[model samples]
Target: MIRIAGLGLVAVLLAACSGQTETGGTAQAVGAAGPTGTATVPGVPAATVAFEGGDQLSPKDPIVVRASGGTLQAVTVTNPQTGNAVKGALSPDKTTWTSNDRLRYGATYQAVATAVNPAGAASEQRGEVRTIKPSGVATASLFQPSSGDFGVGLVLGLKFDHDITDKATVEKSFKVTSSPAQDGGWYWVGKREVHYRPKEYWKAGSTVKLETTTFGMPIGGGVYGGQDVSATYKVHDSWIAKADGKTHQMKAFHNGQLVKTAPISMGKTVDTPPRGPTPTFNGTHTVLSKVDHTIMDSCSYGVCEGDPGYYKAPENWDVRISNDGEYLHENLKTVGVQGSDNVSNGCLNMNTENAKWFFDNFNAGDVVEVTNSGGPQLSINNGHGDWAISWSAWQAGSALRG
Candidate 1:
């Protein structure tokens, strides 16, 4: 006789039959083939399997799996080469399983899902996926004051397109070198931007170089995009002057040497402006920022006369003298009354050539002193030309302290 065993194939049969005489005693025929039959066994059912939609991911990302129409008995993920295993458990619905830990990058992983039905029939499903390595770190850009320009009063700025999770790794890849050593430091302006500046103005003749080796760095969460970049800049000769409205005369210096003397006109005591009790200038001031302009008679220092300071101007000769709106430029129309008479609006009227000569000679750090201007010395926050701040104060703003 044939018998079927539950869902899996297993065979068992009677060895033999004995033959005996008839009469009243009964015996089975040995070779009679009484009930020649074959045994049938059912095949194990296949378990339906699938992966969650987010299966494709970086090494630092998670993996999820789903199975259907069966009770999940065991779920495991393994690396075929190393036999390393990741343990996973079935969800309450018995159709889902997940691995919380992140997978290794650039690796292929296999998942074996085991399931059983109420009939105690066992089945298995297999799945495979490859985890990719994190993306390469992107390049950082040199920010502030574009290359190949003259009279750029800007800090050395660096900006990353992506947020930097690994600060040490990113920092290690950065380097700044100047021909003449500068007391400088990096300050984090934002997650993507950083600024570097010296405690004082750059040396008159210096070459600056910046480099970043950002490729392949794991910036954050295993996602990185950085490139190797380098830049070199030449520091030009320039002068930035500070003027106090309280001081009436302007002194010009070249490379720390007193060079020229020019009489200046300042805001009258009655109309003292408030840059700081007395108006002042700061940072590396430049000359001749622009030239030629129209003049508007407007209320200044709480005083606006219909015709008080109205003059159709020549080119706007900009000699950045103070943090406030003070300058030492040619005021040809008001030249006769500059020093002896504080007749004009708050500007030091100089001869045009003198103004041009001063502009041409002075670099970013050359000094111009203005007295009789009623204001405090320029503070740090005033302008890009904020050279007035003491060296100690400037050093305090560094991100990397040594």
Candidate 2:
């Protein structure tokens, strides 16, 4: 015999009373007794299952479940393909169940919860969600001074193919080593490019190595790529050359020792214009800056005002040997004034910084042996003075450079 509980009988009676009876048909069944003094339908298990929270999941977070008005029997969450499973028990009140496991990045997971009522019948509910990985490194490329060129001004530059998420990690991958070691640091120019220069120019005759090891860096949210690279170059010799305007000669030095001395023409006195007069004397000067192409104008030096003769010059051959407008450059035209007293506006005219091997070896601080100029030594303004300025003077400049 079927026995209906107080609440169950009320529910059945309400359903039966809602229906109308026909003339020949018996009265609709009600309560624990139907038309024949017994309930026609069997009892329905009282289980009710549901997820406490909405069916959504985060990649690396946890999920919760709940069941009510029943006895919760089991709770299981699993990754179908991977067969990874997590099992938990429901609270005694049959209200909730919770699984403890961090969801995997870039993965999908499934969960199923079950419960039974006092009658021993069961009910179930299921859910699914997907997770994604964070972005990261794709690739990198190193450029400039391609592998074998040497000297102080050889700037190490790197370009990246993808934007990096972790700049420090990517930067740490770049490594530098110098023989006859000197201290230096890397400065970032932009999103993809970075430049490395010694605190001063490289010491003459020093060896340098550059390496990039950005192989599998997580450069951003959900991306990754690239490989390792390395390049090495040698500093051949110190080719510091001194140019005297009055004497019209350039003396070269190597490794703090005297080498060949060559005749050079300097800017003429009339050439000194408004920009500022280049120094007249010669001394140890380092190559501070170099340009491949530039416009040379007499008006820039105050030679002529408007429409002064403009020369689209090949600056590649020009080497800025001093802070002022002075440069050690090739002057195929002024070969006659090289050995004798013939001044330029301020530039030191060389046959060729490259041809003289000056470009090939001289660095920012190597000594340039200048003597015999009519005036005082050229003032230090453009580049860092190595031995050109006294140690005390150099220390003073350090604060400014920083």
Candidate 3:
């Protein structure tokens, strides 16, 4: 059954009965009790209209005709007010016919169908329909990450304001591709949200494309797409830095090749008062943006400036990767402890030289994966955390993933 989510509908299902049989058209003889209690034959033509006379309809509903006899000869759906025909297509076998374009709401339409028998005879039928008026229009809202330069795991995210009941019609309208053309799929992350990603991590210097014809598409009884949207993302160099707190090491990869292995200090495993564990989160992330220098305040983490937990410093070469305030930056006065121990506040602390090298080479969108950090994995809603979920699990979120 087709589900209707929060759609205001007029209660008139669109099917009408055509009495018995007709001449000249291929029909089956259905045995029936005659008026005089004798057996009689009822004619039911192979071709018939899908809508009932004077029935209230929806713009998203299919305007169809069923042909079971020989083949579909002709079908015409037109607005009586404008005298323009609604374009439609016939199935290969000619057994079914359907409208190809969207119908208009609050408008009256007339549908006429004809099918030929094997004997060259024709069967004709016609029906009138009136579409329902919608209470509100739902539009698609795109939530793409940073547009400039990005890491290899960036995804194009989209969210809608309303629930969708028609998955096939709506999903088919999307067209996501790449300049070099990489295979990818859209996963439903929520009832109103979708995320698009390639089968593997995107290659460096590749361009991703996103297009949607969902505008004006009927998604439910009364809901239609509000507008069309498109975007292109530029993938920069592959700069993936993997940090492990337990091993106290950070490995940087460039274009699938190992580039550098720097001894680093990560967050501590113990939790402090007012602030939770200083450990870094474990999972995939992306470099959202970078800063040359910033004032690092201990009070931001609920610690007083003069307290034992409070320590103020001007941080250097900061690269933010998550909304939880984790960063890959330089930690002055801690170069000796970096290689041998974990002793910082949820950051990958590097020496000045290594931090300067990292700051010069990396940009927004570079993948930064952390592991064994003694913290929870980054969530899908986190900064560029779309790659944290498994592919099979991610695909399950889509409405059309069946």
Candidate 4:
């Protein structure tokens, strides 16, 4: 027997009546009754619907139809409201039919079964079951890598419409697979958000898929999963840029081959208590997004309009690497001093030619490692800073971890 989880259902046996079976106004005598008063007919088909007691069924409960005394011809369960048939599978010997897909809540389904006896007689059985209405439904959706090719450093991010108290059950409902299987796990950032990442960066040219069969799943506090959701994304070639603050240069690598090395001006050391210095953060930062042309304003971060060393100017080829207002963008004024000095606020100042080339080569999910910046390490909560955490520490964030 299959165990039903939190469905509040009581198991009961369903018995078929013994007597003449009629179909289309034609009556045929079934096998005579035995000592137990149950019909035992040879070469006669018998069909029965299996369910727990009561007319109302939980969406988590599976609809099952079994055949006896003959081979089953076909079985179908349809939702009249949506005009969609429930997906299910039949046993190898044609003895049982079991639903394979999740059912909709607060919906009614009609089950029909047809069987044939060895003597070439056919019989049909029909039944109806209604799914119980959920008190509330919880919804979730993927917010990162929105269906496109990205760099290998991508981490799948899922955000819930509401708070989910039952993290383990909700996490277990997800099915994440890759073209070549890679080990990965989900880490809950909070009650409403979760992130998934592989043990290492995704292999180049790998296709990853994430799906959750949350429909009808019991979430905590009498809430069920609203519906199922899924996403598919592909990983392009590995593109990583390493910026050395000490050398004032950034090196670009593609598929482990050094492609381009360009001079860059990092954030200058201008310490202001509370808000801290303007030095660039030192860590492995994932590329979040890119803008072809945008206005770079120092006041947007911390420097004010009238404050010293404050400036707002139109920038080009801006690629945002952190939420802390750090980016790789073109700044013509810093071009002459690019390789020799650190003069900008917090962004990496690059020449127009090199900045445009970097923008054309790298997309989202790419990594940019910064070193010798003399600033605080990036936090995991800052933009795509998933790589900031160590492997063992990252695994410890999982709710399923012991």
Candidate 5:
């Protein structure tokens, strides 16, 4: 008689008439269509196997195992060549199993699963597959300001080394937080640079942190990210200056209260030839850098240093505001015109005493907003000139929608 199995063959027979002993003795053949395990319930998973299709696979597809008329008893997917089991979880009912880890590219994988019915009969499946080979991998570099007190006009920015076709994916991997909360938005200035600035100036003494997990991320063009990025900074003070070229005056404020007002000479608007339109930038600017002493030369502006109109003079108290050569420093030769008129290349000019006083009083990251000049407005890349971009226009450039 056949044993308890659905296959068209018997597992063993008692042979009650042929056998002479009281114990069972006869033997029978096992069915070829039975499960891989010895329990021999039915055919291999009966068409419900998750990987029934032939397995030349994508890198991201999950390896799965399922049962038709039974509960899953065992399932394990592994990279045979590496001997590493792919991590996965089984369903609560124990009827299904699937891989949860991201598989490595250009690797071969194998899976085996066994299921048993309520009647104790069992079935199983086994298969192997190979994943696609990659053509390229992407990478990028990150930049963040070192730990220091920044000007009130603080802007957090990032730079990538590659052309990212999937911008939203790249942006989603970053996180930004601040103490004393801030209302800020990130703007994608160009294809690769994203800048985040507050709607108003950052609150004084606030701490901000920016982070990104793009490293190892699977970017487009088969490129992976370079490394993780993170940085924290402090907002120092609220020293804001409104330098009005039209009024030939500058007013400095400390903590939102007026502290000092000085008559200043801004760049001229065709008030003199050769220096025509040397009118200072007419928008918001941040103090880029400072030099205790340096030679002020016209050669930097393309004028020959020794030319009749060009002068190379060693000046003191030079605080730069733009990469295009704008400084708020004493103009000894034109000190007479400073309070009286706008003369000198696009810079905020002050008398020797006043210039030295302001320079010594201000710190890095101070704001120098040159207004009332009929000149070109400051640009996004013009030395921390993030304030030059309007808030609305800036928000429109973000990968995240308004």
Candidate 6:
């Protein structure tokens, strides 16, 4: 006898005297065929199961399961070897189940789904899916401010191991948060690098953190992500130096309060031979590095040893503000004309006393705004020039921008 369940009812199909055949041999029991190529008892209907992406699946895509002739009862996807189950969400109608997490690269997953018919009959189906293996893997690292204190103007930088073609997919994995929260967004410097900065300078004394769960992330060009990355840093007091080319003076401020004023000699207006113009770039600049004593050379800026404007000499208290060979350093040769004349070569030349003071107070990630410098605004590609862009324009750079 075989029994099947229905809506609060049970139907039994029994064979008459099936213990033996007329020849005294044992009789075989047979049933009807089910949709899954299996045998099912008579009067019971089999539920249909469908798996999205069938066999070869992309690691970046999600898995979906659907049922027909019945409502889905239960569904689970798991990695057989590791016994790790994929997270999924079931539709309210109980007809669909969708994966919530991304699949792993070159990994196999097993899906088991059960569906129940209106008559209360249940049927189950199991299937296997394997994510495509990529040719290469990509990773990322924090390129600036390694878990320490930085000025409010600090821009978080990240460098990717490979050129990421699917930037939106990669960017979506990143998470940035702060204690004293401020609005910020990311800007791609190039295919291999990205930077994050607030609409305005970060609030002083705020704590900022950057993280990305890139493992299993598809980075385009058959490249998958490897490991996750994260970094946390504290924002120090806001240190700003405002330089006025017309007045030949630089005013230093700490946390919105003016701290010091010093006479400085900016770039000369005349174009130096072999080196072209000597005017300093005008706009906001973020400090990249600080050197107590270093040799200053014109060759670094393309003015070679035999060039007319070429010179090599030691300088003290140098704070680098741009990749185009610009610094705030002590220059005793122009001390007499520091307040009256702009006679240096694209640098803010200050007296020894004032230069020492600036070096002691300012740090990397500090800000320097130059005005009336008689030069073009600094390009966003030079140093940490993120602040030079307007807030609206900066937000437009995001791949997910509305």
Top of the candidates by lDDT: 6
**lDDT tens digits, residue span 92-178, model 5:** 988778788777666777776665545554344555656655454444444445467777877788887777667778788878888
Q: Candidate 3: what lDDT?
A: 0.72
The number of the candidate with the highest TM-score is: 4
Q: Residues 1-402, candidate 4, lDDT per residue (tens digit)?
A: 112222222121233222123333321323445675434334332333342213556677787776656566787889999999999988999878888787778887777676655543445566676787877888887867448888989989888887887888998898889988899888888888889989888999999998988777777888888767888999999999999999999999999899999999998876554344678888989899999999887788668787776778999999999988899999999999899888777789999999999999989999899999877798877887788788898889887894
Better of 4 and 6 by lDDT: 6
Worst 10 contiguous positions by lDDT, candidate 5: 12-21
Predicted candidate 2 versus true structure: per-residue lDDT over 176-258, tens digit per residue: 99998887666554466655656655776678899876654455555543656677877665555656555666666565576
Q: Candidate 1 local accuracy as lDDT?
A: 0.53
Off by over 4 Å in 5: 1-144, 306-308
Deviation of model 1 at 305, angstroms: 13
Tens digit of per-residue lDDT, candidate 1, span 274-314: 32222333224434233334352334344355544433444
Q: lDDT of all predictions, in order shown?
A: 0.53, 0.54, 0.72, 0.78, 0.70, 0.80
List, residue by residue over 56-134, the lDDT tens digit for candidate 3: 5656666666665556678788988887889989899886777877777667777767665453334566566677656
Quote model 1's TM-score: 0.48
Q: 1-402 in candidate 6: lDDT tens per residue? A: 123322122222111111111111211222344564334344445455676665567766788777766688888989887889999998998889989886777787887777665555555566667777888878788878469888888889788888888889888998999989889999888888888999889999999999987777667887887667889999899999999999999999999999899999998887656556688899999888999999988788677888786899999999999999899999999999998888888899998999999889888889999999998899888887889899898888887784
Q: Which ten contiguous residues of candidate 2 have the minimum total lDDT?
A: 12-21
Regarding lDDT, does 2 or 3 come out ahead? 3
| lDDT accuracy of residue 96 in candidate 2 | 77
- How does each model score on TM-score? 0.48, 0.41, 0.62, 0.74, 0.66, 0.69
Which is the winner by TM-score between candidate 2 and candidate 4?
4
Clashing residue pairs in candidate 4 are none
Task: List runs of model 2 lying over 4 Å from the truth.
Answer: 1-143, 152-154, 160-167, 179-182, 189-192, 198-207, 219-228, 242-249, 262-307, 312-327, 332-347, 351-402
How far residue 235's Cα lies from its native spot in candidate 1, in Å, is 2.8
RMSD in angstroms, all models? 17.5, 16.5, 12.9, 9.0, 10.7, 10.2
